[model samples]
Target: METIGLIAGNGRFPVLFARAARARGLRVVAVAHRGETEPDLEREADSVTWVRVGQVGRVIRALKAGGVSRAVMAGGVNKVRSMFSLRPDWRAMRLLGRAAGRGDDALLRAVSAELESEGIEIVPSTVFLQDIVVERGHLAGPPLSEREAADVRLGCRVLAALGPLDIGQCVVVERGVVLAIEAVEGTDRTIERGGSLGTGRAVVIKAAKTGQDMRFDVPAVGPRTIETMVRSGAGVLAVQAGATIMLEGERLIEMAARQGITVVGCDEHGNVGQS
Candidate 1:
């Protein structure tokens, strides 16, 4: 009965959100990026509007046309692409002027503020998928060794160190040796970069920023993540409990198990468990 706005980006996350939201009897009004979003989302969304990247005002206008006043940002845009490929409109240019310096979070916050100024509220993307959060504990495969755990702690510290800069949310490490820190290239590439440097035992840790704004850009991992980890020889995937999204929850964990990779959820304090 309610109408929700969805600002969709690339990959399966937006499609999943559309299906889940519609099932709850909410009208899904989606503004999707033309090249980044999956074309199949038209089947899942009640209404879909396509825009190129950086057309913030256009997105808001489309949502308003659909009678939506609340929205969620699902999936992701390639930040590198956004940096180099955007064609900002007048409003987006203004937004970029105000939000240009602080990295991803600042731009998202500015976008949210702009939407609010136009009477649209940005909701948490998990509004309909709360149960899929990576809970604290060992989710699949063997338990992590003390050495792996140390790497996890180190990863957490590194994320905390980097988060305030609005950098990426994941890192690949082994025995405290850092392999890759996720920048605009994204999580999978970061894992691949780190994994290739090691001898089949790198650990990938993904977490929220130290001062993360949960309304947008929550870290997510999916089947492709496991596939990448498998290819890169990363043996463990650790995510921050209750913050990271385990996309396609069961299948992702199952894939990790089949590949003999550990997928555990850890707390901010580094305690590990499954529940």
Candidate 2:
């Protein structure tokens, strides 16, 4: 079987990707983060090497030993925990030194470059499962109210404007007011905060940066997102169509329907089509 390398992080994404790769007859050799990656992944991946947060050298060594010339990064490492947990090797330190900025895109790009330099190409995270990606449409729940549609449009515009800063991919808006812009706290927390401040009709928008590197850090939403919105009283979830991935999409839509939360896939111009 053909072998592929997986740089696995936290959540189901890694396990899902590994399962998909294996279903296609690929041997998955995974480098899993010590605390961040789920232990269940060991059952999916053919082989797994556990490593510390910033152990780039070890990751490279493991992949090379597994004969992996191409790899995909799946899931996410908690940025806050990573600050304290990172144990950078010399290679990681060197890449950090050369990185232009501390933003997600900047740091990931630097890491991808380093991996490519070692003859290991970093492939797009969605390579194995393209169908999960959102397209421009009304995915679930009731058709958007005019007010909700306006909020979605406003949120998209705001996220696009903020993209260049590489601050975050998510924003919360209601009635033309911007409630929250995601920072280090991440999407769920951002939703919680924004939902708390809204009139129970907040719209959540998630999108890629203007020139985002799709090889990693792709924007994703799942069932947990709907659950978060339910708790926060947020009424709508709008993601950038063609740029966002929806994990467990069927379950996600079902959850949204049960909660009466509108889930939409929107374009840059704020156009959202019907299902």
Q: Write model 1 residue lDDT over 141-238, tens digit each, in one string.
A: 88899999999999888988887788868899997899999988888889999999987989999998877777885788899999999999899999
- Name the lDDT value of residue 15 in candidate 1: 95
TM-score per model over all chains? 0.97, 0.97
Clashes of each: 5, 0
lDDT of each: 0.89, 0.91
RMSD values, in order shown: 1.4, 1.4
Off by over 4 Å in 2: none
Q: What TM-score quantifies how close candidate 2 is to the native fold?
A: 0.97
Count of clashing pairs, candidate 2? 0
Please provide, for model 2 over 1-275, each residue's C-alpha lDDT reduced to its tens digit, 9 standing for 90 to 100: 78999999888899999999999999999999998999999999999999999999999999999999989999889999998768799999999999999987888899899989999999998998899989988889988999888888888788778889887789999989999999889999999999999988899999988888888868899999999999998999999988889999999999999888999999975779643
